[model samples]
Target: MMHKPVVDENERRARQEAHLLVREFGAEAPLYAAMKAEKAIEQKDFGRCARWKRVLEILADEPPADLRRSAAAK
Candidate 1:
């Protein structure tokens, strides 16, 4: 019989912290939200993906001034 490997305490704590960050920040944490969104997409979970996309939309940063000005000039 194969024994289960032990979980490292620090790694566990870090995972917990990351989970908390996702819970607290949702889409405001773009990297975390994007990761979740990608996972959702991979899982074919459209609803979950849409939810994450909404959060991403809400928290998306404005374009830089130069980009905005160039677009305006077009």
Candidate 2:
């Protein structure tokens, strides 16, 4: 019998928060996508990493106004 790994409650909550952010902030979606890509890389999940990388690239072409403002402020 194989047991499923238990997910930490905090990690689950964080994922839910990230999904909410994606739904609420269209422009900030890529930032979350990039973060997912980083996690995929850490897990050695190349396919998921590649998918998120593509999303990040596409979203990066036209950054959200908030991102632009933040970048300009830096």
Find the candidate with the highest TM-score and give its number: 2
Model 2 bad stretches (over 4 Å): 1-23, 63-74
* lDDT for position 58 in model 1: 38
Q: What is candidate 1's lDDT per residue for 1-74, written digit by digit as tens?
A: 99988867644443343344445554346677678889999999987787666545534543234223443454
TM-scores of the candidates are 0.45, 0.49
**CA lDDT of 40 in candidate 2?**
95
Local distance difference test, each candidate: 0.56, 0.62
**Per-residue lDDT of model 2, residues 2-74, tens digit only:** 9998977644444444444445666668778878889999999997787677656545654556444543454
Candidate 2 TM-score over all chains jointly: 0.49
Query: Where's the lowest-lDDT run of ten residues in candidate 1?
Result: 62-71
Tell me the lDDT of model 2 at 52: 70
lDDT of 2: 0.62
Error of 2 at 52 (Å): 0.2
